[model samples]
Target: MNANPKILLYILMISALGINTPLSIVGIISQIAEYFNTSIAISGLYVSSFTFTIAICGLFIPVLFSKYNRKRTFVSILTVFAISNIAIIFTKSIYIASFFRILSAIFYPAFISIALTVCEEIAPKGEEQDYITKILLGISIGSIVGLPITTGLGTIFNYQVAMSWIFAINLLSLILIIIFFPKIKGKAKSYEMPFSSLKSKEFLLATIGIMMMPIGASIVYNYQPYFLQVVSHVYTYKLSIFLFIYGLFSIFGTWLGGKLIAKRDKATILIFQLICGGVFVLLYLFANYLIPVLILILIFGILDGMGYNLIQYIESSVIPDSPELANGVFLSILNGGIALGIAIGGFLVDGFGIMSIFIFGALFLLLAFIILYYIIGIMKMPLKYS
Candidate 1:
């Protein structure tokens, strides 16, 4: 794949975008809280808002880009994403920071959708999944690199300084994307509308799967620091160490996910992985000691990463001809679930206690599993709905 200049450039740019944004910032949530003199829960809202925009913008991006020039559309989105990160660096108030975050989130889904489409457009027809997986690996790398970079930067400079570092990285990455991505000779056939496919059973099921997996994943992620501080009595430095370990091992899980999809059906992998995800959420809830918490989170991240990739693969499978729209819708539902999970988990943490957040996440995922199972079973029936 390195022999292909476009593919190499695509991976580099996407990896920077993915790594430099959310995961990097998540490692600094407490630092953000300290900087703004706000509660950590409120600081968590910055991450949640990023997810909210990604979800809400899913419905409009495909339609908006359908009529726009692909290269300009992508370049514009990347510019917006980079500029918003700059806005984030300068904002003093948490609310203002969150506002910029939401703005940044708007352009993200569009860029991601376009990137996947670009991969497909470049691939040798039958190898779409291969290209798509390699592209998605950027997200995996982001999760890996973002954590360490955030922690290391935070250790040296303040949270705002760390945010600035990520922004600079994004600016450099966007420049690279502008330089290397090939220009389209004319409007591609991919610009066609894809709204009709939203109603398909497979598409709908894949959407639900994407939504639920994050609910389960975020329950743990949202409260991980609290889990370490309160349950494990681990200090901030130790917590960062555990987080680094989680990021490191998760690369294997992500790789495993791509390998699994290459060997089997996407829907089957998503269903099984989601069920395991729920189980991991429950395990995380009950974990109290430092060792158990560390072990479970590592397990959780690995499983969640695998489940996340499978969810995307399933969505790509739903509308194989339109991976752009399918991936957009997939990202939208997934982000919605993430926001919902954080909000719901916050409520549970306050009302029922920290462990209850895990219960709530597990329940939401179980609900998704049941819904998809019924939907899949019904789709096998003789009668068909249009």
Candidate 2:
């Protein structure tokens, strides 16, 4: 099968939108707090709201769009996303901005889902992993460019300007999607039911690990800047650089993960990265030296990037029957776990300290490792890769 350049281009555009998310979010939290004269606790709710809605929608999008045309589905969602981005520019009220965010969240899962679907449809037999990785590379690139640009812009200009950049990215995505994405008209193959494959012990354990990685990563990503600036008194520009490096390394990490998983098995790569990631979480929290903190962030970023890809690759490798639907479940649980992590991390920061969030996140990943090891090690489950 030939790789479609148009589809890849569309993925790049949508991935930019994905990248804009965290950058705009972290920047806005501080401004939004000051704008309303509210506490940081209140501003943090925006992150929770975004991820929570994403989790809910990820569970249902595949089923909802099962019979619908893929092109139409994506265009409709992108239209809503465009409107939401434009609305954010004018809406000063927290409730209004948040309402738009919820709207955007409803459609955001398609960004990944559609890309994966396209890749799978076009990939050669036994090359599914490579295709998925390349599609995900769009996400990696988006984060790399989006974080530094939006964060820095937010610091220099107002949050509205930062928001405008996101809107611009979305507008560009809409245009490319409209111009390039082929109208893929087809009916989906109906599955028996979701979570039907959960009976398999290997799937159950792998899913648990898949769920842990995103939630654990988001715990730090969602709130680390606030911790550094508000709690540790780091300067805004300096923090932006740190965040940029984190995201930049994230892309590299994900690319490396694709290569590693292709050469080895997903389980071995996942286990090593998760353990190392957990250890770095602790090191990041205690390191007072800025250099050490930056180093830890780099390490953590690589682990996270690889881990995210690992989850998707593992799910497809394990279940090969319905890759997109399997990914849907993976995304749903992973996102839900992310919301939970943020909610818990936020509460801990409010009650205990910023550092405590890392402790909590590390524990989450560690627990996931224990579950993963038992299935792969004790039960002697087949590795996803054949």
For lDDT, the strongest prediction is 2
Off by over 4 Å in 1: 1-6, 9-23, 29-47, 67-69, 90-100, 185-195, 266-271, 274-278, 281-293, 377-386
Give the candidate number with the greatest TM-score: 2
lDDT (10s digit) by residue, model 1, range 308-347:
5666766666676665677787777677776777777778
| Per-residue lDDT of candidate 2, residues 31-66 (tens digit) | 767665577877888746777776788755765565
Models 1 onward score TM values of 0.82, 0.83
The positional error of residue 68 in candidate 1, measured at the CA in angstroms, is 4.0
